[model samples]
Target chain A: MSSNTDFVLSIEDLTVSFDGFKAVDKLNLYVDKNEIRVVIGPNGAGKTTVLDLICGKTRATSGSIKFKDLELTRMSEHQIVRAGVGRKFQNPSIYENLTVFENLEISYPKGRSVFGALAFKRTAEVVARVEEIAREIMLDEFLGTEAGLLSHGQKQWLEIGMLLIQDPELLMLDEPVAGMSARERELTGQLLRRICTNRSVLVIEHDMEFVKNIAHKVTVLHQGKILKEGSMEMVQSDPKVIEVYLGH
Target chain B: MQVAMNKLFGGREGLVGLAILAALIFIIMPLTFDIFRLNLVGKYLTYAFVAIGLVLCWGYGGILSLGQGMFFGLGGYCMAMFLKLESSSPESTKIQSTPGIPDFMDWNQLTALPWFWEPFHSLSFSLVAVIAVPCIFAFIISVAMFKRRVGGVYFAIITQAIALILTILIIGQQGYTGGINGITDLRTLKGWDIRTDEAKYVLYFLNGALLIGCILVGRLIITSKLGRLLLAMRDREDRVRFSGYDVSSFKVFVFCVGAMMSAIGGAMFTLQVGFMSPSFVGIVPSIEMVIFAAVGGRMSLIGAVYGALIVNFAKTFFSESFPALWLFLMGGLFIAVVMLFPNGLAGIYTSYIKPRIDAWIQGRRGGGNLTPTVPAEPQDPVSPRTAERTPASAASRSLAAGIQSEPSRS
Candidate 1:
């Protein structure tokens, strides 16, 4: 009955269906400010769908998603993004045809409108910001490198850098370390921990070891619903979580 | 100063390309061809306007519109209607039943001018309609399709279908649209006889100047942040959307720009060719216009102009000599260009010729002080042979080099 305004993101009984099957069903989640919440699930647990529902990539059949008291359910994807909810896709989705600097500049959150983009100048402020983000993502040297030529790990970082430039209040990263090398995965964990200090981060990750390193709290999703939620140690030890997901 | 100039054009390569194109259109072609041949070249240059537009829409924005001819036809018809009305004055058409109406309308037994055609009596209104009509139509189509997220092959088919529908409508409405023959016998423009050799020369120069202006405008767009966003959106629409952009609005804007450009070409066509017809407003001509963009290197504005000139010149050459083989040859050229040099002439230049020229230039510089020029090389890490396969990357590599080198300078 009572909704919490203190939380950065509050999702109450969110449900989404395709045909007759519910991909995300009656899910209630709340993310606190400056918290790193990791969602772990086996295949078909609707972890990605939960992110989609929040980012407005998929419409919910019922329930509400509130970001800082703003109803994200009624907004379009871009509007939701502009409202400070940034989503990174499962794959590394950088613009291959552009340079790394351009990839970062495109996501700088300025000149987003049609006319704005046309009139957008590469001001020193913009260039300085782009350079800062590129450095944070460990891609300062590759500014002129064609994004398509980057390694899989670099591309993933570039996508994260893209989201960082927007500086979204609530960040949703879908499998940030998937297909990454062990070194890359560790660096990503460090990157995640550093970046989440200023804003809430909702990560959908499958790797348990990586999850332990970055998760302030862990939520186990099973069949469109949360099976367990607690600290990483608590969720790892939960029998239901083990049987449904971690056991595999 | 050099950086500012590079920014104004695409880069040094872009400036050279523009200069070469200007020479061909303004100096070489004018000096070589007689008025009749030059008029035909001017007509082809009008199509260059449409091709340049396609470079932005289809090449950069990644929205393939196969119905450019419809906009071109609309623009040409607007100009034609004004010319037709001017030529159809009471004294000129006194023998017809309706002394002040177009001959085709009078022949079809129409007693008065259609309400739609009434505004064409004013030169200013017709001139505005030449761009406005097609842009409004393009805006509607882009919004309807792009808002629904329909794209790629489906979008192309829908545009082609619209072109066909417009052609059929023009043909069926014999009374209103001059039927399949279109609005013809255009004699004067503001009481100036446009059929004279002097008028032809003036119109040819005007069309050339306009095409160059359009290319410059296209260059401005391609070098802007918007152009980079278009490239980004084409590759990753979701990424751009999540970056807080209304993707459909950009698509609609570029499509409308493309439509406006095609309309200008059409109006110029009517002025230069002395007619506007359904043949140039249908599916075949629409696809042909796309080929012009494709063959010219869809990614290159200057290349599109050259593409229009090359393809149309071949069409005239083949059709004049071996009329039966022209169609087959045209098809073969399209196939060969797509398969071999996918980036068109611009691709060939960037991938093969430009690099060789660059290497020679470097060689001539005695390989000393390679550091300044080496910045351009790192942007394109791939070998020239590999770059040849993905010509767009090679073209954009230089573009990126120009852009990346800016912050350092400042």
Candidate 2:
């Protein structure tokens, strides 16, 4: 189905199966520009798999994932990222060996080619951008901190800052606040809202309160299929969504 | 611009590494040993090429290719082919049944030169092939494996298999490849007799210079963003790929660069040793090359040269005096190096020697008080091998060397 031009990411009839079992079955979803969408489901309901499929980490057995005019199913992970899409892993995947500043700098989008990377310089513009993202993610003070030394909440924020550094048009994060303290979850909710002002944010989270606080719209998946799609209140009110996901 | 270049050249660790290598090549070995022994040191430096390349591919890129000797052999064979062709000139080999063909080819009852050996008639072609062949081979292997998402042990296994295949192919095609004896008895390079003592000294210095050049190239790659990308890619492959870098392409490029480095070493080895044989091309030598990188800090390119020379020197020293115990000693050295100091000799220097050296330099400058900005991490204690050696005015700016030297400490 052709979603409106405002929708930056649209999936049509996406299906992927491992051996005889289908992980994602005929899933269709779309998110508009600057809209923060969250997909929530019980475990094994293919919540994370959707992000994987969108990011080209998991190959779609058969489907079309269109980011604007581009068909992402055919592209590789790096190509998809270059095409203005960024995905964060469920676990914080920040570089522990490098400092927070270096981690953010590496993820910045200006230089990806081998030669480009060799000649890359850290200009004032880049430093200002990294600092700005760090401030947004509340990691500005920890710029010199080795990422491995960061608290679990700071590491999670740092990962978000890394994605922000790339400034992807459509950012996808899986379980952004799964292990955060209550204060961290609150700050992350606000951070997601602030970052989504210019682009799209797709989050997969189990923390209902955090998801409700941030998501403009919610999609519920059950058995690799969309079970409900509506505003957070409407989705929560649905008996089927409540039975499969929210009731837990 | 100045700061970036300093880090790129290995800064303090690099300065220390360069200083040590210079001492070994130009000063210590030259002064202590006669020309004969110095030439032997030249022989060990060739492997330093392979080891330094390993620092790029295995240590930094994290691709443990157990087939570096394949590239080295190919490069050496190219040079050997050129030398062999020159030595087997129509005038020199008039006694042979085929006047123009190499002696080994003639001995194997070949009436005509093999089609593959036809290109060796041009020294230019042989020279190009020395770098091109190994790089092309590495490109093929890396593209096939890395593109397919095959790495770690599987990639290592495949590379080892490639080494096996090459050795078998070279040996089995005895007529074409000079058999297990390999391309040997190489004499002159275009009428310049390589066997002369004068030529030996020239080749030795040339080899040392090329080794330094390769170290600089390694420094260039590792210090640049591409180098940091290699470190990031190794630690978090998906993160890098997701960061919009083509991970496989980076892998292929570094692998090719490493292969090219080894080929130069091989060409130099052919020049210095006067022969290229299967002894240097087989699975054992291939694995032995990895030990050179490991015995040096795999992450430290300068450490790699020292690693290669030290290991080879020890090998020669032990095998000469206690021939029966040499193998056991090598085995123990490798095991002990791996178990006790996984970071190798460079690790010891950085952790212990470099810090003390830094303190001595700093203590002299600022009356017994090390700067507070330094020692952010107690474990990574070292700096300014450059500043220590050079005058304070130019060297003061090189404390950036501390960060560069500290890259692999973690």
Best by DockQ: 1
Q: Each candidate's TM vs. the true structure?
A: 0.94, 0.93
lDDT of 1 by residue, B218-272 (tens): 8778777788888888989999998999999999999999999999999999999
Q: C-alpha displacement of A140 in model 1, angstroms? A: 1.4
lDDT string for model 1 (A1-248, tens) is 55899999999999999997998889999999999999999999899989988888889999999998899999999999999999999999999767787889889988989889988877789889998998999988788777776788899999999999999999999999999999999999989988987899999998889999999999999999999999999998999988877787
After superposing candidate 1 on the true structure, give the runs of residues whose Cα lies further than 4 Å from its correct spot: B1-4, B367-376, B379-410
DockQ of each candidate, alpha-carbon based: 0.57, 0.52
Candidate No. with top TM-score:
1
Model 1 per-residue lDDT at B170: 98
Model 2 regions lying over 4 Å from their true place: A1-4, B370-375, B378-410
